[model samples]
Target chain A: MKKLIIASTSTVHNSGYLEYILPRLTSFFEGVKTILFIPYARPGGISYDAYTAIASKGFETIGIQVSGIHEYNDAQEAIANAEGIFTGGGNTFELVNQLYKNNILESLSKAVLTGTLYLGTSAGSNICGVTMMNTNDMPIVYPPSFTTLGFIPFNINAHYLDPDPTSKHMGETRETRIKEYHVFNNTPVLGLREGSWLEVMGDTITLKGNLSARLFQPGKEAKELDSESVINL
Target chain B: MKKLIIASTSTVHNSGYLEYILPRLTSFFEGVKTILFIPYARPGGISYDAYTAIASKGFETIGIQVSGIHEYNDAQEAIANAEGIFTGGGNTFELVNQLYKNNILESLSKAVLTGTLYLGTSAGSNICGVTMMNTNDMPIVYPPSFTTLGFIPFNINAHYLDPDPTSKHMGETRETRIKEYHVFNNTPVLGLREGSWLEVMGDTITLKGNLSARLFQPGKEAKELDSESVINL
Candidate 1:
């Protein structure tokens, strides 16, 4: 059976995100060949040095520039040859936009079902949900939210954090934002704070992170995940 | 020909909405029978007194008690009897959530296409865009952006106001929010300020309000509108 290691963000350039995943990743993909999907980092500009720096941590890393569908031959080959797929974090909207523009999200989803290991962090984690409509990012842009890649049945609100006490504004809180999503969405949401991740192996899901994930059922108060407990939905 | 008026918000309730529509509405809608769609006012509690107070201002007022698709009978009848329709504002997410659940968004869109005069205010105005996602209310909750009724092709960031001088915080200013939206969204957005109303009289769009409206398009600096201008899609 194939194994998957989905992270919350990439450690390549983001030292903080790297610190969170580097420890757990060594054992998670031990002896397994890893191919990193770096489409999310387009805004940061792609460089061989950057790719090698991230790869130097342990597993072999091959970067896939998935900017358009016409260039998808390499992306398809990458998904086929990889033991597991690691999608880095950047902008979920931009990532999904590129995915749809290149028509690879469906192909990747198919690969996951065929037992190819799937890993996603931050924006990558968000596309796991039913739709990308609930991202905390600005909504001026419209991406295809009809059907997500669906590695997870529910949507992931990555980088979920409590309101900063230092900030003062009248805007609704993150919890309120999730509740707004509940008003129209039947799918439950996983509020994954930074540094937290979900591990999917076979049919089991394990939550790993500092903050407890919060789940909201429509018309009900949000409930916190049990102390490091994994619940099958 | 059927007519419709969607206000920026409900006149009888909420702050920042205009009362100008109340007096003129009765005149413009004279001798025409109508029904007021109160999907946006669900949070304000649609009491009979409140309904009459708004209804007495013009033709006839009726609240849509639609919470879900199960109310198809009432939903259908309400749309059918009214020569025109009106949508009031409270929370855009709540309004869109209820409309989507009841599956009446497409029907309402059809109504508008067939020459139904629609007047929207505040949250009501926010829904006029291609994506109901451009709201300034912050993501207090995640509502479906893909399912907006699509009355207009562009997005609308409603209740556009400058930052208060007396306030201090780290939140992104309204100007900043619009800038972020432009990065990913190619669709132009109009920042409709409070007391402003975008009136559509058969292909004619007039910007009427107390202040100039702000317009943001991808790859361009934000522009302000001081006089009535026709938005050519």
Candidate 2:
């Protein structure tokens, strides 16, 4: 069984992505022979190419075009045979849709439990929650329920941050947005800021990033933690 | 019955409060009778004497020293007879908790329906959600299940914006934060930026502010609108 490495995206267009994850890739897939890429998130869009290009940086990448229960065979084969699985980010809603449409979330979960070396970033990081209800993106599209891959016990608020003073778009501040998530959820939410990554190696969840990560527990003050802290799942 | 106005706070400071609301006060209360100010939000803290100071602006402002349900008599009476109601900005979680503890959210909702001129800034603005589940600030304290005044059918994501390039805080971007909201919610959430006010008069909801307000409907593209455009909610 391989380990699961979930990450928040730093940047895909620049050297940041490689700089952030290269060391982790070396530590996790040190002796692995091959890598399989699941780029279903981009689905008929331009990001497919973008992510495929990004994933190709570390290993031999293959884009999985699977998208429904009928596509389960292909998904299973990809997960079962790949030395490591890399899931890229895009739109969480779109990712959930494709995963559900193909009935692959469950398959992927099972694979992770069996040690498939599961790797996810951004939107991919969101699906690892008990329910992917706490993502930090828009639902430009929907699949079924916002429920994600469910590899992790708590909800992940990916790409979290405080607002920029110069931004012109009007919307809820990040803090207010997460608080609202507590209304429907009893599970804690991990507000993972940009440049942060959670390394899930053999049942251990370690926080890796600068600044304090905010944790929301119902009826409690938001807890902040530095990157070196280890959060027990 | 009085008219109701809820403004999404862009920034929360002593001056920000006065600049954003002074216009609404002059325009709405123009020829009206006395204004009853509810300063129940401050609790025991007398930092700025915000209540008396706001009252000194020439309105008959009375501080509601009530904290729990036992001291909620004036809340009912004030809502019933006031020419107009203005709920100033402070901590929304505190305001919501007080309202719930006092059993006044429902009453305030009724007052709005009956046509009380209602003006809620910051924390006050947050309580207008159907469930009060919508708010953009940190959940400093937990309140009863995300329920609010319900003046607005959907949730309010106040002070929405992108991430600050210079700030050190780590969290998800505002766009991703709201996208997560869409996963569990079917109702649209209005990302009302600071300095933005949603004027609700006799069921007419208009988006007014210097910036464009973004509206997110689950499974649809986010829509942006500028000031003076009416929202049919």
Candidate 3:
């Protein structure tokens, strides 16, 4: 059986790091004393140690200790031995690049599939999808491949935002970008709004959090899925 | 001599397509007849013919004719012989993919360098830079490489926007994204805001338009380059 909590973002507006989801994390990570952290996304280009410290502090409140994967001599072994695993968010390209560089993408995917407890937020959660095509992050780095863990059937557009009706900006809105994505990609995409997450237990996945998520299918009108809805698609 | 009008966007807020910069374009493309159009970006996934039609209409306003490269017997020959070339804005990934697939990247770059007049809007202008790594586009398709024309010494963040002071959205700001890019990339980046453009004549490049553009260099503070400023870096 597989168990994971994939969140759209670690922090919401007016909240501390991971503060909004601490309670859920506490329950989800119950009985796990320490978890391995993959901090390669390096939000704002922070050092891996510094990023891990933040994740450590966040998990600390839940009475769990966090160790960065970079701190280990054998990152594959770290993922293999981790009772619980947490991947932090940042630039998806960098995260995917590091995953390839460290040659641990397979190990991480296998661990999660074999039922190691897992938590992913932002870029971390985006990897659970079919590809990183839906990410909003700038292409700061090029990964060996756009393919990801494929833990979920579809791809994720984390920090998904609705178009501002009043804005006059000409940049493609999130919705427009994803639509462009559908032009070349057949994979379904889930636009995960902030404060929203998906709780996956075995083959059943449910939208957890209070917000509704937007789902996009190629050549189909986008529809909103309410919280707690079963997201089989 | 290199002659190019690399603009941040073709349309500004509340304006007709290419209306904001028609006068500049008329003078920039002086003496040119039919300009070759690269519609590979295909905004909204519009068909190549439909997108070319839009470009034809826009160029027609300036007494110029437009023909999409797709209509040509050989795209490479079309680029090589074009009196003036215009690549319209759309998805950067798809644009680069087509450029690579058609084996015209080198020809287009060589043609532009050999003194053919050219105009690039949004994604098209972004390719004039050293790499597409700074692009704020979704990775709808993968290209052969992030390397680009290198017409300029740096990279470009087209359709660049300023951070909203009031917004509480946790998504990384445009500035932050570029900053993260600098972590792994050493190239200088110019944040070409909407309604702004760069005029390149021979070896001289000047920022044109009413607003100032932001310049980001590795390990240094970002500064604003006002209208008519020379952008040598």
Per-candidate local distance difference test:
0.59, 0.64, 0.93
**What is the per-candidate TM-score for chain B?**
0.79, 0.81, 0.99
The CAPRI classification for model 2 reads as incorrect
For candidate 3, give the lDDT of residue B182: 91
Q: Rank all candidate structures by their TM-score, best first, as comma-separated numbers.
A: 3, 1, 2
Model 3 has a DockQ score of: 0.88
Show the lowest summed lDDT stretch of 10 residues, model 1 chain A.
A62-71
> What docking grade does candidate 3 earn?
high
Worst ten-residue run, lDDT, model 3 chain A?
Answer: A141-150
User: Per-residue lDDT tens digits of candidate 1, residues A44-102?
Assistant: 23343453344334342322221222224676665665566666555455667667776
Is 1 or 2 the stronger prediction by lDDT? 2
Estimate the lDDT of model 1: 0.59
TM-scores of the candidates in the order shown: 0.64, 0.58, 0.99
lDDT tens string, model 3, B28-141? 888998999999989989999999999999989889999999999999999999999999999998899888999999999899999999899999998999998988899988
Please give the fraction of native interface contacts (Cα pairs under 8 Å between A and B) kept by each candidate: 0.18, 0.12, 0.85
What DockQ does candidate 2 have relative to the true complex? 0.11
